[model samples]
Target: MPQPPIVHTHRKPLVYALVWASLPAATLAQEAQPTVLDAIQVSAERGEPASESTSSYTAASSRTALKLALSHRETPQSVSVITRKQMDDFAQTDVNDVLEGTTGVTVESVETDRTYYTSRGFNIDNFQYDGVGLPAVYDNVQGDLDTAFYDRVEVLRGANGLMTGIGNPSATVNFIRKRPTVANRASVAVTGGSYDNRRIVGDVSGAVTASGKVRGRVVAGYQNRDSYLDRYNNEKQMFYGVVEADLTATTVLTLGHASQTSDTDSPLWGALPLFYSDGSPTHYQRSTSTSADWSYWDNVQHNSFAELSQQLGGGWQAKGSVLRLEKDSDSELFYQYGTPDRQTGEGLFAYPSQYELNTEQWVADAYATGPFSLVGRIHELVLGATWSRSETVDESRYGQGIGTALPPLEEWTGSYPKPTFDNGISGSDWTDKQTSTYAAVRWTLADPLTAITGVRLTWLDSEGVSYGLSKATRYNAVETPYAGLIYDLSHNHSVYASYTEIFKPQTEVDRDRNRLDPIDGVNYEVGLKSDYRAGRLKSTVAVFHTEQDNLAEAAGTFDNSVDSYYRGVDGLTSEGIELELAGEVSDRVQLFAGYTYVDIDTANGHTAKPSIPAHLAQLRATWRVPGTTGLALGSQVRWQSAIRQNQGTVSGGPNDGQPIVTRQSSYAVLDVMARYDFARNWRAQLNVNNVTDEKYIESLKKFGTSAQGFYGAPTNANVTVSWTY
Candidate 1:
């Protein structure tokens, strides 16, 4: 349950750094006034340049690792920033779209309303808002999280044990919210795209008081879209509002709320079969739908938060925040199983059910950061504590006629009768409480070398009933440590190494019905980073290794046991290398590019998690038209290596017991964009994605003869018009 230090860097800086290299010569020559000094200080402390108005593809600095603002060249691990400009240029409306374009990350859209993300051969379960952590929803994201309310998204690509509870070695995602601006600003955008997709968004921010000490901001958006799949449609609405007040010269207060709702019709519970009864692959039209007409999935989420900050003088500050989040899910789903006959189009059966889930979480955090003189040199330190509690309840109802055979596939129209849910609810209720205290220090070991060391102590307790089974456990003083060293080779380059640890509690039971112990892991990373054009452009080459112990491996059920069990595993390792370059490339060009390679193996030398691609590459670039005003063009390409999974043969058939392997070959997708400004405050843009109309599967696990395999989206285009003031 170890969590990150809750340092509130969103406030004004406690100190200032004066660097003349990156600044314009004219501005740098005459900027010693107190007001100008404050502006410069704020730029250094805000973690990163606010991406809302910046048209750059990269940021100057970020603090996702230890809450200490550091430039990209100083961080010891890999990090990526998805800016608002990039999102707008590419029409990235949701979290899934943003992550799919990021380097070294994969978005696994396994179903219509659910998604999972992976990096470095592990699942990403750590998510944060600003600096506060949010508990994941059972290891997956279940709703459509829009990006209209965020200023930017920062992704740390390694074990961030110092700043998260689970210490997952995969990655951590931090969403920075758009704050109220002192200057009045407003914008509105309308977009239309393929598949009957239409969207509109509005944003307003300005001073709410005569003295300009109080400011408020609001953002709202609505979207309706129909998919290429038959009978599938989705509608979503999102809202965000925030207010800020300066109570004193050195004290500030902020309050905010956010809500979103999503509704989908004919949402699929499972994918189409990949193989036929004769042991050959089955091909279906891209528009085919296996979901029943009555099936639907609906989700809603709400978040409320408040924070207070005060300046204590002497380059020190203190901050505290509280957040509460609630989520609800409802669904009626249809699933089809069994491989069909190639000639007869028979052998498929249906299973239908109704399900509901509700989850709520609360977190309170406070921290202090300041500068100290250590051995005649200035260093920084952060001390903080966090407390959080989460509760989840879920239930499912079995519908009548769950095992009815489907009609012939060639003529299927999803006209199966809706089933009646007469069975009682059957599900689980669970709760978790965690408390943690952490401290970290950045030591100025030398003029060109710095060391970062931190430790966290956590206490966790869980108690509740889960599916007719007892779920009671306690852990105390779970200590996790972090260490890193950064050596500056020059003003524009650095080399770094880091070590961190992470742990996760397990609920899987053994054959004897005993709960398995928590899984633990460690991560090691070394990299070289280069900065160009005064940090306007950056590059990184990193090599990383991760190891996990006590992993859970599935074990078949024993006598009288209806549920399958698992045993502890040891020595699971993943190693990888990553290369990335991002930021302004030239006077009239901007770019973001990356390549990743990863391999996972068990102790016995066999490959693990084969469904994940071993190679990934991406490039996105934009260029201003030569000798033209307010005109730009962009292009993007994403490619991944082949992936495969073995599903075993169909039962009671001629090929029974034979190996069934499903594979997806290497594929690449291309996208293009064009934008023009006809007026000072008005502009229009167009984007075309998957220009090649590549046909490929989105994911491979749980995809075989019986069920579960989804196709990627086909060629699509969208146009947006916006006016700003």
Candidate 2:
């Protein structure tokens, strides 16, 4: 692939205007007289700087998006942070749970353990661990990392070209780990919930040396639960440990390890069929099971990491990190689908299969950041480089009785005999490698005005070998650019505009056995950000447009001589607006709210993306009792518009080659929570979700067919007790 020239000429006028407008502020600041204060008195009264966990619903500052310590209003992009306090209050345990409540994000489930996240009409493919990028693969199962070891999760919307080398222009999520604390602390908790769910967690941290230069922390958790579906249960275990040492006054070294494992019995592969053979809709009970009792799925993941940080002269700082990860999964499941007869319940078939996967990944990065004087103004700059590699192997076997008709639904029970895996087949072995060099600068053109500009140069290579066939692909020296301008209108308000680009390499081939060009994406965004009550409350209103081109699509019929042919097409375009508010509204009240509206279209407009709602809204609030010091109560409500199922044809069935478009109704769910601190170091809480128990479809066609219409969870409640010392 050839590199494209950097484009900045179009944004020069806007950048100039912001710089000119800030000159007055700069002049006033220089001419104003400073008031002298009593140094001794001020020093005695000043408190510690706020940490990330200070607020229940908002963070004081973040460094995930740009590797710069900045407040929400200081960064010219859409960013949302989910704090530990918020997660604890809601009893969120995993990455999926945390993202479900975030602004402009949506989660859809394809199976019992598989989920997909999306934002701005595109799939979110970028995930970072402590600012280091991780590979996102589609064919393998994701571990759905546990949140117990993380202090917070930060989401940056739009193209993150500088940090993530190549990906979709949707968003990037960064999980910030909890560091060892200087002071000793310990805590333990136990929880019991509906459907026989039980969980226990322990956390401890302290200084390992008498001088308090070495610190260590450990966290462990276990959970066992049974689902609403019949004969389905799961067990999960997590462990994390870390050590931090101050080799010198200005240098630090850290090492950490994390492990997670999950075992599930009778895992569901897909949902019940949505329609009957006669073209009429079918409704099944939410507790209906499509899995047999003998099937199971097991997954395990392990990660080890090391980091070093040093302070150089002239206020400069340098940091480096290395991480290795290993993951494995094995599953034997049944997928029952196809339209059934309305009266006699016939024509339903079962497909049983088994799969095994193993993956290993290594990633490393190093960066240096500091401030410099440019034209008598102080500006900040960061330069970094990253390298990563991943390898995956997969194997599978299918049952011989696949496609055989099952008994009538009326006489069927949840218990069914497990099928045999006879015809075995091995999938391809794949490897992916990436290297990138990136640089960013925060230029203070004048007081109250700043410009952020960066670019990443990337090289990617991939190879696959399957069943005696081998292929290799490469994308060399591709460039992705980013630019943003932020102007402060007042002490509490700011307006900003940004532009970013995305590059994604494709593996499709043309008629002549030549690979197609990579897909290109450009994103444009403008927004207003505000802060209230001294950074305790934050809000943002943003509008964005994204365009993608050079999407590989089938162009002509398959040729026996050279396989199938494809060509680049004018790709998808999306425009949307988002609104978000989070943090303390008053002394005793905290709130979080968000809304999104998106419109998407393609060049031909022949097919629409399924299961994407046009409108979404969420709100949650908590209030402490005025007289009762330890009592608090909260509630949450979520609403979304109708979704369309875009299944094109039945493909050799009763409704063969016929269009099958089904619309799922909109829905709203409600939840409530209460907490009481009975003693100084003891507390108890309860949470009731889906209070009304409304039955609705959570997703339609999450797996590219109406046969996978997943139902939402029913009403459930949980209670927790904790002790701290």
Best by TM-score: 1
TM-score of each: 0.91, 0.89
Judge candidate 1 against the unseen true structure and give its global Cα lDDT, from 0 to 1.
Answer: 0.82
Local error of candidate 2 at residue 549 (angstroms)? 2.1
Residue 117 lDDT (model 2): 80
lDDT of each: 0.82, 0.77
| Residue pairs with clashing backbones, model 1 | 4-163
Q: Which segments of candidate 2 are over 4 A away from where they belong? A: 1-52, 139-144, 409-411, 466-471, 507-517, 550-569, 604-607, 649-658, 702-707
lDDT of 1 by residue, 357-444 (tens): 9999899989887765534456677788899998989888878876688976667787888989875557879898989887777777
lDDT of 2 by residue, 1-725 (tens): 34332222233453344333323233434555554433321111011222333757887777766877778998888898888877888887888778888888877766777767878877787877788866466522364567888888889888887788874678888888887877898999899999999999999998999988999999999999999877789899999999999999878899999999988888777767776665666777787777877788888988889999887856677889998888888898887866787777787787888888788889999988776554556677788889999887877777667777887655556566676788556565978898988777788988989988777778887787543334366767677777889999999999999987767776556656566767787889999999999888999999999889976655543531212457776768878899999999999999989998887778776443546888888888889989996999998888888887755555554767777666778888898999999999999999999999988876663442343665778999999999988
Angstrom error at residue 454, model 1: 0.5
Of candidate 1, the 10-residue stretch with the lowest lDDT total is 11-20
